[model samples]
Target: MTSASAFWIAAVRARETGRGAPLFIDPFAHDLAGDYGYATMAASERVAGGENAFIPVRVRWFDDLTMTSAAAGVRQIVLLGAGLDTRAYRLDLPADADWYEVDRREIFQHKEPVLAEHSPRCQRHIVIADLGGDWAEPLLHAGLDPAARTLWLAEGLFFYLTEPMIVDLLHTAAALCGPASIVAADIIGTAGLDAAAMRGYRDWCDRNGVPPPFGADDPAALLHAGGWRAEHITTPGAADANYGRLPIQPGGRQPGRTHLVTASLATS
Candidate 1:
């Protein structure tokens, strides 16, 4: 079965594509999302009592960061739990750059058909493996060089994992990264786990078979423990991350706020 969570996110991207001045566009998103995705998204919005701009903003932020990494000469880009992401097909990447997407076999089976009609801007490698287990070996076997400067993205993925899993994932990526390799991820703060505003969404996740979202109080500290130096961290409404779409103002604490982070490997 196609993952409900992955389709739900694709549904959000599809909505973005229809916006007059969208943050980013994914032409293949609507088909990828399908009727199931739209239904799930509508149900989620009804449960949460409104729409959310978080996913759209998060998508835009990651896109910008990926382009920046490519421009900086990072040749290997990996997306953990890649879901229905279409960066390889949509983004303008360097000719020599190779983008690797890691996710379960089922998701790829569902995704590959939708993308088969499109050509990617860069070399795309699909490594099918369970993220909950030892996926590093498969990635290396797929031609991910541990010596190359790489960009690792864990977007919209960490909340589904436990703290230990998150740590293991970070360490695994760090082990495969060379000096100055970059890692960008979006994480919910620990406060989001039980925040009143997140109750409905949490329930929605539970009903959909997705675990309740959990995260660190200090994501920087967590990254530090895995030998990654947190270079930038910002909440959704912060000046750097906001794209004039957030309902709340740019300052003050927002309930269930997600943090966008960029970190670099501490050493080769």
Candidate 2:
């Protein structure tokens, strides 16, 4: 399966290149996304009815969370399914910390050349592994210390995974992360996956040869079952998540809700 990283990079480019002050700027996004990525994003937007602020808002939220975690002295940051993410270059991460970007081989092949001239602020390691398989092995082999406090980010990743896969991934992450580690992710509710309001999105994925997206109706409960203590759970249009770009009230819940979550590994 082709990694959809490029298309996401295109979305970042669109947001960063906009007129208004953007939430974050990804300077490398332009070269990483290229023409094909932009075309794919445009096609998806058309298929989904219109461009939405979900992607950009989530991007900003994750950026903020990463910065906060880094500042809190959590030195090991792992971006699972890292995609064409340019956080290491864009964010002012801790210089003493190690940033791990884990994804399949092809993603790096496409990313390396464009970022060859650019230098990351922190120690960045590229880990080659498919999330569906034994990714923990490669990640550990890449020098991820199990005893270090880690910030695990699975942004825009859980939706593509099956429920069982999600559980397994969380379990693996919990096993590897040291005490007091943080895990942040985004997940669509079952309503968003199956409700008529999201039918267009489902259809668009099908047309693009991507697997049907998965969702959890109760994201907090799902995280709890997977040995995590959900600290915060909020939808995309909520005040903290939305930067005045979403078309809703500060705390309004839109149709097809996508929940952004922050959790800590359970001690038990």
What Cα-based lDDT does every candidate model obtain?
Answer: 0.85, 0.82
Stretches of candidate 2 off by over 4 Å are 195-211, 248-256
Best by lDDT: 1
Q: Residue 135's C-alpha lDDT in candidate 1?
A: 98
> How does model 1 fare in lDDT?
0.85
Superposed model 1: Cα runs more than 4 Å off? 195-211, 247-256
Over 1-268, each residue of candidate 2 has an lDDT whose tens digit, in order, gives 2366455555566556664788778877877888777776776666666665688888899999999998888899999998898899888987888999999889999889889998999999999998899999999999999999999999988888888888888999999989999899998777767655456656767898767888876777778777888888788778888888786544423345678889998977
lDDT by residue (128-191, candidate 1, tens digit) is: 9998998999999999999989999999888888777888889999999788899888888776
Spell out the clash pairs found in candidate 1.
none
Q: Which candidate is the best by TM-score?
A: 1
Error of 1 at 152 (Å): 0.3
Alpha carbon deviation, residue 256, candidate 1 (Å): 6.3
